[model samples]
Target chain A: MKHFIVGPVETYKEVQNIYKQPYLYFRSNEFGEFVKETLNRLSSLIGNNDKNSLLYLTMSGTGAMEATIENCVTPKDKVLVINGGTFGQRFCELLKFHNIPFDSINLKWNESLTKEHLEYYENKGYTTLFVNLHETSTGQLYDVKLLSEFTKRNNMFFIVDAISTFLADTYDMSKYNIDVTIISSQKGLCLSPGLSFVSLSKRIIDKIYKTTPSSLYFDFKDYLKNIERGQTPYTPAVFIMYELKAILDLIDNSGGLEKWLSNIKEKCQYFREQICKIGLNIPTTYNLSNTMTPVICDTVNANELVKYLRDHYEICVNPCGGNRANYMFRVSHIGNTTKKDIDILIDKIQKTIEVLAKRN
Target chain B: MKHFIVGPVETYKEVQNIYKQPYLYFRSNEFGEFVKETLNRLSSLIGNNDKNSLLYLTMSGTGAMEATIENCVTPKDKVLVINGGTFGQRFCELLKFHNIPFDSINLKWNESLTKEHLEYYENKGYTTLFVNLHETSTGQLYDVKLLSEFTKRNNMFFIVDAISTFLADTYDMSKYNIDVTIISSQKGLCLSPGLSFVSLSKRIIDKIYKTTPSSLYFDFKDYLKNIERGQTPYTPAVFIMYELKAILDLIDNSGGLEKWLSNIKEKCQYFREQICKIGLNIPTTYNLSNTMTPVICDTVNANELVKYLRDHYEICVNPCGGNRANYMFRVSHIGNTTKKDIDILIDKIQKTIEVLAKRN
Candidate 1:
């Protein structure tokens, strides 16, 4: 089946083969070298100087986000969360769970953050600003440049959950002044779901050392000690590490992040253009991410459209839950998606619309 | 290379094949059914009642242990940890980190937990008892029957880390009256090292609901809510779950846990007998686990012996760290280990001893 759902997206052949190899011993020097090399590659991809520390967590993207919150956010300092979509709401949920004092700038599903919204939090004394750079729910890409400048001017640490944006967009930790950037394997990495990566600048590391977290699994101090020797404190997803290396190598071999990001941009642009031609509404007029396109339906049910595509064409598209379940469906352009695949999907969706009208 | 090191252990062909399949979308009904089925299979294997809830954590054994501690033990509760080896000490570390008031029964590495030791903690107002059923570091298997009766009489909750011994031994959660049983995939299940599982009784679940844990990744309440619908709060190690189902099916096909346990017992017994014949000392003469055997070296350095085997025969053995670095080496009998493999390992060890003696 052709998979267009957001993540646990289509995987590369070599990466899947790497995952198929028997599990490597986590304590072996060979695995240590692999860990070191992967960290170096990640550092280069994110444009990190040697002053930062990157950690590989054996969990989902949400797990990595929770880890960052637990390690960085304390009740003593105030935080401001940008709530635009499901992933952004997750950061709010995490903050609430930890009882961290925080407020949110809730953007409507199809809306983007503007300078007017930034002005409200300028002198309000939020020590940290948390956001989902590409909110997966609405396909709205939050302006990292504006947020970075605002946070830097106010001397607030910035944390970005780039789970769905890393490889699909040109992201640089140094350029954006992102203190912590969290990503996962299943998104733009095009690997399986399991491992989560967090890259932290020295500033965030210093604050993390000073603060005490409520978690043992995501304790930064323990990770810092183990990562110095190219290991985690506990056993990680061994095969996923190998797959990550394979994907990283693929990106590097194909002219690195610049080429990879442009490829995704082209795919997303082509998909959006076709959807517009098919008379569907794009959910957002703002800068959209090159990850997924959330299309709004007026006459037909989104669930029905997703079902029609899956049953007839053997293709899977994203089905929204909660309030938008019957209104919007998403199509991901990340992973190993191609222009030909998008064209086929558009044709199928066109047929689906006609069938829905007849049913009506 | 032949893997005799504790874990990540060797994998079976069918299990590897299952894991090789491309990633599955987590939000799909297909995955939800898989999750439900895997949990049911795990519950049946451990003899858990319908009232029990089993959670699959995307972490190592230690992470699961911390989850149990965080959700159950609070500052108001007094706890008793049974410290025998590395894993046992880990419980104390977690308890300390949480600031949960606790005392411990520090047993010698090879010593058994007898009735006399239990008498001290009995009726002492301890709310919970934490122990590692099999201490992986020392190859010592603690008696479950004795601890069960003591905890029951004392009206204390019992939490056991059965990581290295779960599939190798006969463990009945209902029979043992264990409130929580922790296990990892890399041990006797012999899959890969990515997922950890915890089985909890209804009583502990009630307490977990009332307590606010210091962690979000290890949050039991969030996990419980999502798991009721056959899901986790975050994306998990997708392929590892497939391998788990494959191994669980293999166990069920091979006459269930009873036969599987006996096979491991036979392998462990055969290995110990061969090493005894070779004039090597068994570190623990007490009740030993079928998972691994710790061989005590009096003449040559254990590290040197491990290195020699790896370099000459391409066999990897577990070398001790800290004080035991020069004294002992471990050989695992779990996974798909065979009698022929054991014979080959013994022959290589004999040659290693001879070579070390020549150097001396």
Candidate 2:
């Protein structure tokens, strides 16, 4: 309750202003137009080559992930999953739920994913490759472009869970030939957690037509059918949709895509520098996420450190969940987070660590 | 742009206040507890009877309807559906999608459904009966109690799409032996439109377990499995959950269930009386919904009158969509609507109708 837990990041005043009004119902044409405009802006931001690229909104980034698995794979379809952290394991869970056959290339939580893992799966004749562009659980960003090229060369569908990295990273869906890119409103979009979006390439859309429909609510075909009318198959999270529109306007007004990406880069660099100065090491050797940094502290208890920062300093950071909690804690730099906010977080964390050391 | 229309009645100020915050991420335990508490409050409001009754949430009222059908009936399964209004037509659509065999007892758009229909269907060996508590499109509220008794005597599963009725009507799920009851957040709950809920009796749960999985996302079993742990199978509408909690709190704080139902009844009476006083004939004799009034005005173009009211008087009223536009227009009395709001709406309608008569 004292604030620090990564995600659902403390929203800025401007972002909160949009959420204050009752969401105009989605059945109304006004909300429908807002969705259309938001999709156009996102398409422009991503530089999608296919004008027919479809954006389908879901409840969360996880929902989008489930949608990808449900929409892309049929029973007994072989899927190649790159597992580096909790999120990677999630793909395995989805595969299990659908009873689809999947082989996972397991990477250590502290390691970055390389192209070799994908190449291994390609040789094994896997028809679909699933990767997390930004593995939030481990704070590692994958070489998505390289993986996308490998999947394309192998004639396999490429799916990227870009939930935490989409806006922060240079994600050009056109250049990467990414078949499906998933994102959420809460992380990089800086809106809220209720909405997830999946942008579909024509290749994957075609594949979906052949796959068996497992879930009615997250059926990609259902989404595709209704999307033409600027409507979702089900009632969308209207307030989140409104917040997404507002956030898009803010992003567009803030010198557009390139500037926004640069801002994230700068923030990530600042965070990495601060972590290095504090003698903390980033867990993953691969490229770090622009959105968050998973740091390993030799002397600090990650969970206690998180609580100390929240209770004593009013700064919220996420303590890694499950097995990762022992050695790592994450600080997110996504959404409308600024250098000033990060600086405050750093100041609190430094003080907390010193007090924690004294107590030990 | 204008607000009125039957559904998505103006959200309460308190409900809007909760939506103003960034939706807390689903992984947060706080969010999970909030949803659990909301469900608990709903259970209390409905009055606890059977421990086997379960509340499940979906994206919209229609989504809940789809879930009810998809969960209970497999492909080629026999279903009895009452065809009366847009909502009932949606049940037909669900039946068509699942390729289920359905015998529909079609009632005229503005007609009431009686127990005789159920008796007729029961004799035909239909195991499942689908009915609407309030047919929102035609402003029809059926006698659910009579249908429930008939279904019980026949040992049939009774499903009710109570989207616009729920708290507005004096009915109990246990009393009617209604196996499945679906309602939306915005209509009777005074919340926004992002969430739909279904209350299932023990008999329906057993039927769902025996049925083959139809949809992954809309699977009632998955929802029921996770609901006990205060979790949803996917990311839920977090902010709406918060708003629902707030609305429930407000409802409870304001003298609980009895008071809320009484307020709705009072608003319905006031609106119906005002419409009659303004020389508009009620469209249906026996099936008037407490949540809204469908008025027949043959002298003026209903669409033009609705537009004039919105543009000139700054009053939002929905012009009926499609074929229904020529014969009737509806004004809703759901959520936090009061006599004052109804009076303003009636006044605007009177002026608009007078101006339309002059123009014609």
Candidate 3:
């Protein structure tokens, strides 16, 4: 079956082959070099090219978010989190769980975090600003550049979760002055899920050293020490590392990150146009992420369309859960997806919608 | 190269093939079934047959250890950890980092925990007893039966890190009255690294419900809630989970856990006898684990021997690090290691030792 879920999108053939190789021992020199090179390439891709600045965690995207809160936010630090979707809400939950004092700018799922929204938290003695660059739940890409400027003027550390936005959009950690930038293996990386990465600036590293992390697994300092020798403090997902290296090499070979982002943009544009042509609503309040498009159901049932597309056609699209289950369904444009793949998916979705209309 | 590292061992051919399959979207019903079946099989293998008693963490073995501590141990709980080697030392560090009051029974790398030593902390109001059943650093297998009896009598919670010794040795979590048992995919399961499993007894879950975990990623309560629907709280290592299911099926097909343990025993015994016949020293201060055997370098240079075997013979063995680097090297008997592979490794090691003697 064809998978169009937001993350774990279809991978490149070479990436699949790389993941098939046997697992390497984490302590091996060969594996060390692989880790070192992968981190270096990833740093260059996200514009955080520096020695000993990035760390790989054997966890999911949420784990990386927890790491940032555990390492950067102390009890004394005031924090502001942009809560627009599920992932953004997670940051608020983590900060609360850790007993850190924080305020949240809660936005509806379809709402965007704009420069105007930053006015209340600006210069409020907030030491840190946390946000999901692209909220996966609503397919809304927040204005990270605006947030970056706001944080810079306020002298607050900026932590961005770029899990679904890294390769799909243009993200420069250095330009944004992001203290901690998080990404995962699945999503825009087009690899299997499990591994998450955080690129910590030197300032954030200093903060991490000063505060003791309550959770050992998500501790940034321990991972930093191990990454010095091109290793992780714990056993890593080695096969996924291999896939990561392969994907990085593929990106480098294809004219670097600029061309990669352009390709994803083209795919996203094609999908959005095709879905809109079929008379389905696409939310316009926020800038859309290049990774996936969320179709807003008004007249037709979104869940029924998702089920029909999966059953009648062997195509799988992401069906929303909770309150949005009836109104939204997402189709991914990342990974080895081509315009052709998007065209077929849009055609199948259109047919499913027509079938639903007949049933009504 | 032939790998004899403690983890990332040579996986079975079928398991490797299973890992090569395309990545599955974590939210799909198909993946839900995979998670359900894998957890059921793992619970049965470890003898935790209770409903929703196990949770899978997308991390290494250390992550699961941290999860148990974060979930069960409170600031008021007096903890006693067996500090025998690196893994045991890690638990102490985790407890210390979390500001939990705990004492440790410090044994040398080669030393085993005996009943005489247990008298010191047996009735000392220790609420929890933490141990590494098989210390991976020195291949020293601790006596779980004796520790189980002691914990049961003292009314203390027992937590075991069985990462390196789960299927390689005979382990029955229920029989041992273990509250939390941690295992990883790469060790005795003969799968790749990246996935760690924790089997929490009903007692521990009840305790976990009362305490809020400090870590969001390692939180047991969140995972327990998600596992009811056969999903992890966060995105998991999907490919590694596939390998885990395949390895568990292999164990079931080949006469269950008992037969699997006996097979590993034969392989370990063969390697030990062959090495001893060649005049190499094996530490006898504790019972050796079936997972790996640590060879003591009393006369020969272990580092040089390891390099020679890797370069000239293409056989890779685990070289000790830091203080133990000069004294010990390890050969693994877990995974798909056969008697012939043991013969080859032993032959190469013997040749390398002779070369070292001539150099001296």
lDDT of each residue in A148-198, candidate 1, tens digit only: 999999999999999988888888999989999999988988877778889
Write the candidate numbers in order of decreasing lDDT.
Answer: 1, 3, 2
Interface RMSD of 1: 2.3
Write one digit per residue (lDDT tens) for candidate 1, span B1-360.
788877888778778776446544677777788788888888878778663298998888888898888898899999998898888899999899999999989987668778898887778899899999988888888899999998899899999898988888888998989999899988888877788888999889999999987777888998888887778888887778888888888988888788888998999899999999998989655788888999998778888998899878888889886788788999999987799999999999999999998898
Residue-wise lDDT of candidate 2 within B140-232, one digit each (tens)?
788877777777777788888877788787768777777777888777786656678888888778888887555456667788878776788
Tell me the lDDT of model 1 at B49: 62
Write down the TM-score for model 3.
Answer: 0.96
Badly placed stretches (over 4 Å) of model 1 are A19-24, B22-24
Model 2 in CAPRI terms: which quality? Answer: acceptable
Model 2 misses residue B297 by how many Å?
A: 2.5
Give the i-RMS of model 2 in Å.
3.8
lDDT head-to-head 1 vs 3, winner: 1
The residue pairs that clash in candidate 3, if any, are none
- After aligning candidate 3 to the native by TM-score, how far in Å is the CA of A320 from where it should be? 2.3
Best by DockQ: 3
